[model samples]
Target: MKLYSYFRSSSAYRVRIALNHKQIPYEYIPVHLLKDGGEQKTSAYGKINSKHEVPVLEDKNVRLSQSVAIFLYLDRANLNNPLFPKAFPDFEKCFELVELINSGIQPLQNLAVLKKLKKDFEINDEQKVQWIKDIIRNGLLAYSKKISDEGPYSMGTELTAADMFLIPQLYNAHRYEIDFTGLEKLLQIERTCLMLDSFKTAHPDIQPDSV
Candidate 1:
């Protein structure tokens, strides 16, 4: 197995956490997103992933893109450390947290969207930061409300994909200095998740290509 990834990418970070949690050993191939006109846009990488995105997993003959899909694929392929808790009541509840980060918050605040805002809208750095903060703040608040004082993890005691999604988003939040005034639950979840070795090893700062 191999993973083509960018260290700073939240989506790639999600996959890294999942991989680590499952204890799946794979070669890490770094694709610099901002070096020399972005390596992901190059024809070579483009052929690997039509979308020219990071976090593309290559397992034998299969190549997969998208973090959520990769997480599901990894979960299905490996039964040892399942990403989703089979015994949990209403699996959708756990997925709700994952979707909140993966679909709702992540896409809006990702590097691609930020670059588009700057290039297309001609938004200044200050405006861009404010826009990102507002969107993230609102989304995080909504996500926070979903956690019913569940203590450690998002769903419950056992870590799930929701925690995998949360750690990277929180990393992004901290990068932009997004306000976490009333997000104690989410903050607590982040704190707890980071305590685990899987999350610690998957962190961007420690990755091979983090700059």
Candidate 2:
């Protein structure tokens, strides 16, 4: 298996956490997102994923892109530690949280989007930071409210896909200095998630590609 990844990419980070959680071994192929005008845009990588994105997982005959889809694929393939909770409400709730982070929040604050905002609108660095902070703040506040108070993990006792998604977004939150002022529940979950070996090993700073 080969994982085309960038060290600081939150989407890639989510997939890495899931892979580590599942105890799957794969070769990490670093695609430097910012060096030489983004290596992902190169023709060589285009052959792998025409969309030109990181977190492309190539295993046997299956080649997958998009972190959410890749995560679900991995979870389905390895059933030992299920990414989704086994019950009714918790299972649905896990999906809800995953959608919140994966769809609602992550896309708006992605590197490409941020770069586009600057390139297209002439948004300065300070303004870009403010933009990211505003979006993350509103999204996280809503997420904090939705998360149950019973959690050391997002969906309660078991660590689910929602936790995998949340931790990386929190890493982004800290990276861009997004104000996590009143998000106690979210912060608590993040703290707990980081203590685990899976999350620790998947952190961006410790990755081989991180500079």
Candidate 3:
């Protein structure tokens, strides 16, 4: 197994955490997203993932691009620690939280959208920061309400793909200095999850290509 990743990419970071949690060993191929005008834009990497994104996983005869797809693959292929719930509302609930970050907030705040805003809309840095803060604040508040009351992990006692989706978003929050003021639930979740070795190993700062 091999993973093509970019240090500091929230998508890749989550995949790393999942890999570590499952105790799966794989080669880490670093794709520098920022150097030389973004290596992911190059034709070579483009063929690997036409979407021009990191967190691409190649295992046996299969290759995957999206983080959620990779998570699904890893969960089934490994069979050791399942990332999704086996039951009804729990399964739907997990996906609800995943989609909340996967599509709702992540896409809006990703590097591609920020670049588009600066180039086309001519938005300044302050405008970009404010836009990020407003979106994150609203989304996180909703997350605080949606998460289970069972404590620790997002879905309660067990860590699911929802937490995988979440930890990275919180990392981005800190990256942009977004305020955590009223969101004690999320703060507590972050504190609890980070205490685990899986999250520790997958952190952006410790990656081979981190700079």
Global lDDT of each candidate: 0.89, 0.89, 0.92
Candidate 3 residue-wise lDDT, 1-211, digit = tens = 8999987999999899999999999899999988999999999999999999998999999999999999999988999888899899898999999999988898998889999999999999999999998888788889889998878889999889999889999999998899898888898999999999999999999999999
> How many Å off is the CA of 30 in candidate 1?
0.3
lDDT tens digits by residue: candidate 1, 32-137: 9999989999999989999998989999999999988898899889987889777657477888888998889988977789999999999999999999898888
Q: Pick the candidate with the highest lDDT.
A: 3
TM-score of each: 0.96, 0.96, 0.98
> For model 2, where is the 10-residue window of minimal lDDT?
148-157
Q: Give the clashing residue pairs of candidate 3, or none.
A: none
| Per-residue lDDT value at 31 in model 3 | 96
Name the candidate, 1 or 3, with the larger lDDT value. Answer: 3
Q: Candidate 2, residues 1-211: lDDT per residue as tens digits?
A: 7899999999999989988988888899999999989999999989999999988999999999998789778878888778888788777888899999888898998888999999999999899999998888898888888887897877777898999999899988888887778988898998999999999999999999999
Extract clashing residue pairs from model 2. Answer: none
Which parts of model 2 have CA positions greater than 4 angstroms off?
none
Q: What is the lDDT, from 0 to 100, of the residue 189 in candidate 3? A: 93
- Provide the global lDDT of candidate 1 against the true structure: 0.89
Best by TM-score: 3
